[model samples]
Each structure stands twice: as C-alpha cells, then as structure tokens.
Target: MTKCRECGKILPQEQRIDICLDCSRKKIQKRFRDDPELKDVFKKTIEELRKPENVKKMAEDTYRIVNAINEMRDGR
Candidate 1:
C-alpha cells in the first residue's frame, strides 16, 4: 500500500490517486466553486501581474531563482 499524497490515506497500488476518489471529486472539482472570494482575488492578482513590464520582471525573478537552485544542486 502507498499513502495518498493529498489525504494521507493508505490505498492499494492499483486503487490509489494522489487524493482519494472522494476527495478528488468533492475537493478538486468543487473547491474552486465554493471560494468565490479567493477566485476573484486570484483573478485580480494575475491580471495585475500580466502587465508587460511586470511580466518581464517576473520572468527575470523566476530565472534568477531557478539559477540559484541549480547552483545549489551543483554545489557551486
């Protein structure tokens, strides 16, 4: 048996999802529907971040962060 990643349930190899089936349907499908406030906030944040100047800044920041991770992995 392997542990389900989301709900920490013990399941047989052939029967396991990252989350159990019940959680999969109820949580993944309906969770966003249940959180209108969070969805609006997420939408507003993404719209702000998608401006041309902000997009470039975000890309540069992500590149620098990934470079730092690779350096650590390579012991540099």
Candidate 2:
C-alpha cells in the first residue's frame, strides 16, 4: 500500500503523489499563515494571472512548451 510522505497515512492505490491531499492542504495553509511576505506575493501573483491578457499569454506559453516537447520527442 502507498503511504502519505508527511503523515504516514495509508494512501489509496489510485493516488499517485507521495503526499496526501489533506497534508498538501495543511502545508499550503501553514505556509500562508506563517509567511506574510509569501502570502502577499502569492495573492499578487494570483491577481496578475487572473487578468485576461496574462491568462491568454500563459495559455499560449503552455501550448508552445507542449509543442516544443512533442517536437523533441518526435526528433528522438
């Protein structure tokens, strides 16, 4: 059986990642609660990413990266 890396809870077979969902949520919550600077930066980044132009750019960048990876794999 798979186990959570942080809490040692037995993970379901279908779960791929080492950390369980509960531990991931707790880690993110603790990080935001403990680090004000990171919290602010994360909030700002979220706001920026929510903008329409930024969203489009990010999508385009992701598409480009995927195509590049595909090309490299085909070339191999």
TM-score, one value per model:
0.32, 0.45
Off by more than 4 A, model 1: 31-76
- Going through the candidates in the order shown, the clash numbers are 0, 0
Best-fitting candidate, scored by lDDT: 2
Candidate 2 on 1-76: residue-level lDDT in tens? 8788789999767655566656765654565675455566556655776688776444333334334444644776
Q: Choose the strongest candidate by TM-score.
A: 2
Give the Å error, residue 42, model 2: 6.6
- For candidate 2, the per-residue lDDT at 22 reads 67
Q: Model 2's lDDT to the true fold? A: 0.58
- Against the correct fold, how does model 1 do in TM-score? 0.32
